[model samples]
Structures are given as structure tokens and as C-alpha cells.
Target: MKEVYINRISKYLPNHPISNDEMEGKLGIINGRASKGRRIVLRNNQIKTRYYAIDDHGNITHNNAQLTKEAIVGLCDDDFKAEDIELLSCGTSSPDQILPSHAAMVHGFLKNGNIEINSPSGACCSGMNALKYGYLAVKAGQTKNAVCTGSERTSSWMMADTFEEELQYLQTLEDNPILAFNKDFLRWMLSDGAGAFLLESEPKGHLPLKIEWMEGYSYAHEVEACMYAGGDKLEDGFLKPWSEYPSDQWSKKSLFAMKQDVKLLGENILVKGVDSLKMALDKNNLKPEDIDYYLPHISSYYFKESLYKEMIAQGVEIPWENWFMNLSKVGNVGAGSIYIMLEELVHSGKLKKGDKILLSVPESARFAYAYALLTVC
Candidate 1:
């Protein structure tokens, strides 16, 4: 098998960063009322700013596909042309439409002529899947190069209009936002952005990241859904498909609203993630000291200590100095989070040759996780 290297990395954060105080103003308050959980959630999450693909009044400026196209364009320059891309793999938890796979829509916007494309849809692991697919293709010598993109355009779903219909039934909330804690908490957490990576059989650009290995695991069969959208949860912890609901009930029930069982997430997300991490480390014969930088796609800063403690319990503690995160700066972009982190570190002038970077992403939706090890060269 041939070696695969990430030749270039690019990111596109839409518009300007929205400050914490400006969140509800931009997303709009639900039914002209502010959320009671807003301050508490922001305090715990410790997010200062995040980007949204919308204006102050919540009008969409760029859809998911357009955000992805802009990121891919950033990977092209004098040495590479958009038309010359061989494979384009796009991954996203939030897409612009229901029909036509995400990659197809992105390619349509790119107008990069004909090219092979694939779209891997999941929560946080979608981007890892896209990257692994491209990595394997290049490693197998089936393709000389591939362009992989991860993006999220979830700001549209977080808007007040998306949940206005549900507010009609909120009699208990006299002056506060009407959304349930499950649905409303996500509004302050998610942001819009895209990240792209170029993979090739040989290294290019300064400090190309060599793909050492990729590992992934799913506990969906053993675990119930914890984070979800476009559906409602049943009494037995199963999700009722959005297709089964009447069209009129969609907005009324907020079927498409991004939601989370916060209690369930707190109980299982950390333990499951550490379990997957232990497996990957054992399989690869790696130890904590081997990782020079640890980039974790975490939703909140509150989890920083919890994750470290959980890893210690699992006997895989990487030191505090090894951890690198930008959640406070960029917010959570779901599947796009890991790609954005990787892109930032690739050009931060922090990694030296022989440095090892460990990446971990956990998706609470169905409990899927992915891990990868990269060596700076």
C-alpha cells in the first residue's frame, strides 16, 4: 500500500464572529422572548464567539453547499486547479436540502467539471468518514489526489422562525423562550463553517501531515439516540422518523429542530468516548506520551476536565499541555469541527517534524466515534 498525506488544509468561517451577547439578537428570541437557559448554557460552555452564515436578522447568506465550495476553493492555487480534482468527498450533519446528496450539490456549485463524489452523512463522524474514504483511496494508489470537505450550515435550523410554530402551545412559559431545554440548548452551541483537506499519494506543501492510521467505532446497536434532528423520540427511547409525521406537524412539533437529551449525553458520552479511545490506542500500540497534540471535538469547555478525568480512569491520560481546543473561538460545527481543528493546527507553526497529533470525535447521535493519528513531516 502507498502512503497518504494531507497536502493542504483550508477553512471558511462565514461572516464575522458573533459575540455571546449578540447570539439571540442574530438568531432572534423565540416568540419575542429570551431563553432562560441562555446565560447558564453560555456560562458553562464558555463560548465567547461563533460564526453564522446569516445576517443580524437571521437571513441566510450561504447554504451548506456554498460554504463547502468556498472551503474547497481555498485548497486550490497555482499548483492545483479546481477542475483537476479527482475525487470530491463531502460530509455534513446539516445539509441544504433533503434531496440530491450533499456532495452532488457541492459539485454543482463548484462547477469543477465531472468528478467522482461521495457524501457521508452522520453527526460528528461524517467528516472523519469522508477523510478516511479519501485517505484509503490515495493509499491504495487508486487515485493520485482527492479533495475532502466537511461543513455545517445549521444556523438556519437554529433560527426563531424554525420554532415559532411550537411556541403556540407553550402556555407554561409566560415570559421566557418557549423551546424545551432539549431543543433550545443547541441554539447557543452550534455555528456555521466549513473545512477542506487535500489528500495525495505524496506529500505537498510545508509540513504535510502523514496519515499514520485511522480508527472508528459505533455503539449504536447498544445505545439509544441522544442527539437528533428531523424526528421525535418515542417513550421507549426510539426515534419516530420525520417522514411518518404529517407535513403540518413538522414545524408545530419542531421535528426538524436540533435537539439533545442532555442528561443522557452527560451520562454516556464521556465513558463511551474513552472506551473507543482505549481500543484505538491498544490496537495501534500507542500510549499517551506518543501524542504531542490532542485535538478533541468537544461541544463545551465544561467537558475539558470531565474528559481528562474519564481518560485517566481508563488509564489513557494525555497531559493537559497536550490538549488543544478552539471551541471558545469557533463554537461547535458538528461534523466539521475536527476538520476545522486539523486545519488550524496544520498552519499554526506549532508542529515540528516527527510530532504526533491525535484526533478524537464523538457523535452522541447513535453513539458513533472516530479517531485518527497523524505525524507532522
Candidate 2:
């Protein structure tokens, strides 16, 4: 198979910064240790800034379409005309419109004619999924160039009072007036941001980042573990069970369709993620020591730690402090986290030519998707 390469990448975050101290004040919590601990340990995020889609009135717009447009345009700049682009894909959990998909908005903004565009709703791994698809498309000679982007304006979905109400209900086992006065979890962990990458078929003369190999897997058990729908409805909170209504069986059916290879809450992380990584490497006749950088999904601090330990067990040495940790600056951008990290590495001069990069992402569902070996060129 011909080698696939990622030519250029970029990321954008809004100008504002929301510190833990500011969040503590907003939450009216007297315990500084509690605030900082929640900021670092509980939430597994210490993000300072996240880009939001704001309207002329300066109100935050959580519309996925608007954010997608802004992120793609910002990445393209003036270098390439929209007409020259061939394909565009958006990886996002939040979609602007159900029918048109977020990719359509990006296509409309770019104004590229006769282009094939798609918006992939791959949950948290959507961004990496989009990139993988783009690489395959280029490698298969389907397109000369492709653009992948992930953007989210979660602030629009946040209801301060609603979160508080939900928390109060959980605490009191019923909706109470006292609970209404209490606020939800601090908004520090939730923010808005976007990222984009320009990938092209590596030409004869121009050097580019080469994709060595990629693979994907899915697990369907506990599919109902995570879900979302439009509205301020309170029942859609975390770890809520799938509805008992007959119509809600769709969630169960979807989960049944996605049965994955790994078991739920499996005790072995290295055994699973590293084993998948090894399979990809063995397929390409590569080795773990060949990789120079490992970019695993930053779902949470604990998850990252587990992944690190697993990698270490596999004889891949990586320092926790020196590892590229961006959740502190941008929280979890869902699918965009991996791509954003890669872009940062490139811009900061950390990634060098021929350096191998390994990426791993686990969906909320038990399934784990792993990508191994991207050589920087």
C-alpha cells in the first residue's frame, strides 16, 4: 500500500481564560483545597481557555455549524482557495443540524464546488476517526487532499440551574427548593474549542508526515452507558440507564450492533491497548521501540495514567511529566484532542522528521480504537 501523510495541522482556542480560582468564586465554595482538588483530580482537567461561538450580541452560540465554519476557515486562511479543496470531514459529538451534518456547514463556508463532504459522529473519538478516514481516502486515491476538523461549543448546552437541580435531586432524592438554590458542578471543566488539519497525498518531492498503519475496534456492551438528545431535559444526566420505553430500544439495538473485542472495565490496560498496538505494528513489521511519541486520548487524568502504565509495561518508556498534556489547557475537546495534540507538537518543534507517533482512543462504550505509527516527515 502507498504511504499516507498528514501535511499540515492547526488549532484555535478562544481568547478568554477561566482559571480554577475564578470557578471556585463562581461556585461560592469556601474550600480552596476542594476547588483545586476537583479541578485537578476529580475532573481530570485544568483547562484555562476554550473557544466559543459568539454572536454579534456577544452571547455564546453553541451551534455546531457556526463553530465548524469558524474553525475550518481559520485553518484554511488565505493559502488555499475553497474551490481547490476536494473533501471535508468533521468529527464531532455535537452536530449543528441532524439532517445536514456539521460537515455540510463547513462545505458551505468553504464554498467548494463538487466536493464530497461528511460529518462523522464518532462520539469522543470522532476527530481521530475523521483523520483516519481521510488518510485512507487519500491512500486509496479517492481524493488528492482532505481536511479534518473537530469543534465544540458546549457552553451553549450548559444550563447552570439545570445541573444544580439535577445534583440537588441526586442529593435529596427529589427536587427541592433548597436544591434549586445550590449550583451545579463548576463550569471549569466544560469549555468550547476547535481544531483542524490539512492532509494531502504525499507527492514525489514534497516531504510529509507518513501514516504507517491504522486500525479500529468497537465494543457494544453497556452501549446505554452514554447518550444525549436535544433539550433541557433532566433525565439525560450521566450514567443514566437507557429508557424503558419501547421506542427507546433503539439505544439497546445500537449497543447490540457494536459488540467490541475487549471486555468491560477490563483489569488489563496494557494487555488490551498495547496488544492492539502490537497487532498493527506486527502487520507493518514494526516494533514498539520504533515509535518516538505516543499520543493517547486524554479522556481523563486517571485514564491517561492507566494508559501510561500499560505502555510502560510493554517496554515503552515515557515520562509522565514530559508527556504532552493538553487537557489542562483545553479540557476534553472530545474527538479533537488527539489531532490538537499532534498540531501542537508540530508547531512547538517537538515532532521531528521520521519520528513515529502512536495514538490510542477508547470510546465511552467499552471498545478501544488504536492507531499505530505515523512517521513525521
Candidate 3:
């Protein structure tokens, strides 16, 4: 019954621009492979480019908290005061410290704002999850204003020899050639970046987007499918071990897990995305033709395309051309992708008042999140 709106949004990338060609050069030399055989070159072609935080030594920087702070500062106008901020939530995988969440680090950076902050570790869904929490907080009258941020500095966790070791590990699995190639492809897709947004309960003058409703669906799948633990070892980064689970037992076990946790997440995401749009239409009772834009999670190139296809198959009319695709350029900024895209649309004047936008995010662990925002001029 309560309304939540996104008053402002902003995004930031590191100064270092790591192009595919540069990555290819590094890969070719490291794997002792010909330029043609190196998969990074090929996969990089599918993606636009990604930003990386680099240290003075030119190594990838892993300061997600710093990035989140920088992004928030950039989003806030000079007139905005930190004291006005009631909540600060960060959705991120890379924390400044293992014990202290990134939210604490971000809170310390604020000069005038004494706000309650929370750092969430929802893996890839963190950004969206944080946004949902902020929306609920405002809707429940617990806060008048809030900020949700999603940032990652995975490169900081990566070592120069890391790729080499992974490549070598794949070479050892010569018997599973397809699996090797898949692993190689993923290596190229991994990137580092951060994005953030500012949310207010009530619009001051005019705003581009207003949050109508949000819902989350989480399916607890096999722990090994996607697992990450912080440690000194390089292998502790993102791991997709779906193959490790037994095939015959996977679907059943995964389905069972989904029924209990993971499936509900996916179902919630799908239901929210579809139902929110339907509710908007039903309230006004407008046809599908009346809606204007849609922004789904830019997870991966293949994943994005597959999701669109699935939506279409489910009878959801989506504007394929209007869909903003940025993962190729920015890599996957985890929970930040949808909000970052939302900001881009507003700044670019593509999203207009009265237009309906559907936000969808389907992640690993059988998690799904969906929300609807109507531009209120």
C-alpha cells in the first residue's frame, strides 16, 4: 500500500579500462597458446569491455567499499546532506574485510551522515536484495530516505599467476574438452566494477522512476554449484561446480532444494516481474502495447539472451531492442546492474514519466528477484 521511489541514481568505473585485446594478449602469452586458440579473445568479442580497479603496481584493486563510497558521492548532489540519509545498504561480494561488512566501511566515509548501515552478502543478487530491503524500509515508514549500492573489485583478489594456474588446470582435464572450454570462457567474462543509487520515500519535485513493488524468490540449490570462501588461496574466488554434482541426482535434488528455498526465489522473481506488470496494466487495465521499457539483469551474454527467450516463450511481450545490454561493457556488477541501467536510462532521457519498467534478475542458487518502477513526472 506504500509507495517507494528512486529519486536519484549514479554509477562509477575505475580509471583503468581493460579492453578485450589487452586481455587476449595477456592470455596468449600466459597459456603459450596461439592467438587463435586463446578463448579470451573470442569471448571478449562478445562483450564490449569491463572496467578494473588497479593499484599503483597496476594490479587489479579489490576495494569494493571504496568504490561504493565513490559511487554514492558521485550520485549525491551538492544540496543533498548526509544527515538526510536514513539508511545505507551495500550489496557486494568483495568486502573490505572478511568480518566487517562493506556497509561499515561505506558508512565511515560519510562526512555528515550518521546513518544505520548494513552490508549484505547475497552473492550476485546482493544489489537487488539491498534495494528491496531499502524499499521495504521506506515503505514501512522506518526510513524516509535510503541508499542501495552494489560494487565489486574482484580483480584485487586475482593474482597475476591465477589465470595461468586455472588454464593449466583445464589443460590437465583434456578428457573433458567441453568443460575446459567452458571454464576458459568464464575466466574471460569475470570482471570488476561498482554501481549505486539513492532512494527517497516521497518525490520532492519531479522524478524519473518510482518503485511500485518488489518481490524476491530464492531456491537453495547445491552449495557446490556456486561457492566462494575468502582465504589466502587463489582458488577461493567464484566457483561454479555444478558439474561436480551427480547428473541423475542433480535435477531431483536441485528441484527439491528449489521447492524448499531456491525454486521459490526463482518463482518469486518471475511472479513479481510478470505480475507487477500485469497489476499495472490491470489497475489502468492497459494493454501490453501501452508499456514502454524493460530492464532485466545483465548477468552474462548467453544468460541475458536465454532469459529474454524464456520470457518471450512464457508469453511476455518484451521489447528486445529497448532492452539495455551493458554487461559486455561493464561486466557483471552483481546487484548493481539493474540500478545502474536504471540510472543510465534516466540520464539519457530514454525513460519518460508514465512509462512502466520491469526489473528482472535470475541468479545462481536458483535465486530470482523482480520489481516494477513507474516513472512519475
Candidate 4:
């Protein structure tokens, strides 16, 4: 098989870091140390600080296209022109517009540079899926080089005002605001960033990650509607796209509102996520012991213990010390989390040549799981 190698990666984080204590005031929640819900979320997620693309006044500092452009710029070399990119894959959980695809907008930002553009928009797993698509294309000799990117402005999605308005409406109906909205839980969880990778068939003047295998799976039915953003739940228990729903419901805030079932998420992600990882490893005839390092994009530290226990049950004995994670610093950047985590590791100067790294990603909204293995060169 013709091997595909990821040559380099570029990551762009929008703004200054916001600590948990600062987030309490920024989010307008009273007495964070006293609120049981806030404390549990903080304790469970273990996120200390995260970056936001919005300003202190809750205005967007950068749009999706600008963030994507910055990440793409990082992928360029003085030797390689932007046009040399044969394939471009852009993945995101949030897009700037509904008409022109996010990838198309990125292409436009590059002076309308022409190249085959693929935009995979969905839950968090969309990033891994986009990377795999580009990798497979390069491996098949369809493209000499490809750029795979995952970017998110999730802070824009979980804005406090949106929930405040929703709460006001729910209160008018005499409904419990806390029960009607989950924004308070999510407001402190998701952040914003963009990351891109330059992939080629052969390495050039840089260490390339030789792709081993990549696969994706889903068990949506097992944990349906556990986490979701954008769209209205219907009478049939399905969600109607926000665009299809009445505009009045989103008059002030058109961005998608996220609703999550925290209990179900805790019960499902680790258990089902490991099962999917085992399947991927099995398909490649490899075992957990064969993996040298685990680069898991954990949504929170709450699952760290469960993940270890589950991996052990599945016969993989990799230790906690062998795992690479940045959730504590970056929080969860939606589809971009895995890409940023991978970039941090590559730039950290911690890996030796021939180290086998396994990357795992799980998406809550769509209940998707994905994994990829690579050998550092």
C-alpha cells in the first residue's frame, strides 16, 4: 500500500486563556464555589483554562474564515505555494454561513485559489473523518498533497445571552429555567480554535507521520440525543434543523443552541468509545500493547479513570503516563480538539523517532468514534 504521511500541522488559538475562576464571573453564574451544578461540572471536566474567540463584551473577535485562513497560512512553506495543495478538507461543527460551504469560504479567503474542496460538517468526529478522507486520497495517489483542517468557534454557539433569552421564554411558560436549558453546563466546557495539517505522499525536509490505519464508527442509537447543538427537537423525538424551524425562535440569536444530557454522556462515551477503538485495532490485527502512546482528545478529565479501566478490560495495558492530553488547557474545541492536541504533541519535542502514536476522538452530538495510528519519523 502507498503510505500517506502528515508533514506538518498548524494551530491557531483565538484569544487569551480564561481560567475557571474567571469563567464563573464571565458566565454570570452566581457563587461558582457554592453552586453544586457548577462545582460538579468543574470537578468532572477538570478543565482549568480555555481560550475564547469572543471579546470580554461577548462580541466575536474572529470569524470562522479568518481562523481557517490563519491555520492554512501555518501549513504553507516558503518552498510550497498555496496552489500546490491538490486537495483541501475543512471540518467544523460550526460554520459561518449556510450557503457557501466553510471550505469554499476558506478557498475564497485565499483569493479564490482553485482546488478540490471538501467540507465535512457535523459533530466533533468530523475532524478525524476529514483527516482520514485526505489521507486515503493521498494514499491512493489521487492527490500529491492535501490539507486537512478542523476549526471551531464553539464559544459563539454557547453564548450566555442566547440561553438567557431562552430562559426568559421558558419562564414565561412557567417552566424551570435550569431544567429547560443546559447552557450553564456547556458554557464553561467548549472553547474555540483552528488546526490544519499538510499531508503528502513523501516527506520533504520535515518529519512526516506515516499513517498506519484510520477508521470511524458510530453507536448513535445507544446514546441518542445525548449532546446536540443547532436545531429544534420535534414531537417525533427528532430534531428539526434550525434553518427549517421558524425564524422567530432564533430572532436575536441565529447561532445554534446546544442541549446536552450530561448523565447519558457520562455513561456512554467511555464505554462505547473503547469498544469502537478495540474494533479498529482488531481490524488492523493490532493490540493495545502494540501502541506506544495514546493521544486521546478527552472531552473532560471525568472520564480519564473510566477510559483506563475500559482499555484495560479490552486488554490494552498502556499506562496513564503514556497518554497525551491538553483538555485541561484547551477545554474541548469541538471538531478541532484532536487536531490541536496532535499539534501540541508534535511540537512538544517529546517523541522519539519510530514512536507509535494512537489518536482517539469521540463526538458527543452524533455519538461517533474514530481512531488513527501513525509512526513518528
Candidates in order, TM-scores: namely 0.97, 0.75, 0.75, 0.91
- Misplaced by over 4 Å in model 3 are 24-45, 55-57, 60-62, 111-113, 163-183, 221-290
Q: 200-233 in candidate 1: lDDT tens per residue?
A: 9888789999999999999988989999998999
- For candidate 2, write residues 139-177 as lDDT tens digits: 889998888887765554443332343344354554422
lDDT, each prediction = 0.91, 0.58, 0.60, 0.79
Name model 4 segments beyond 4 Å from true: 24-36, 179-181, 234-236, 251-255
The lDDT of model 2 is: 0.58
lDDT of 3 by residue, 1-377 (tens): 46787777778787766676666443234455433434543453366676667644565444777788788887667677666778998887557676677888888776645688877676667887788788888888888878888877665444334445444455676633221332343345556666776777667644546877665555444222332322111244333343554664333222111111222333344444454445444555555555577677744464455555555665656767757656666766666677677777777766556777766665553343444556555
Q: Provide the global lDDT of candidate 3 against the true structure.
A: 0.60
Give the clash total for candidate 3: 12
State in Å the error of residue 343, model 2: 1.2
Q: Rank by lDDT, descending?
A: 1, 4, 3, 2
**Alpha-carbon lDDT of model 4:** 0.79
Which stretches of candidate 2 lie above 4 Å from their native place? Answer: 23-58, 77-79, 161-188, 203-207, 221-272, 314-322
lDDT (Cα, tens digit) per residue for candidate 4, span 1-377: 47888988899998789988877555554212323466678888999888888778867788887788788888887787787888889888888877699888888887636799899878788888889889988999888988999888777665555556655665677644452435457766788889999889987655678988899898866656777766655556576777776777873333276777677687788888888887888899977777777988887898888889988887765787779899998888888998899899988888788999998988878578989999988
Better candidate number, 1 or 3, judged by lDDT: 1
The better candidate by TM-score, 3 or 4, is 4
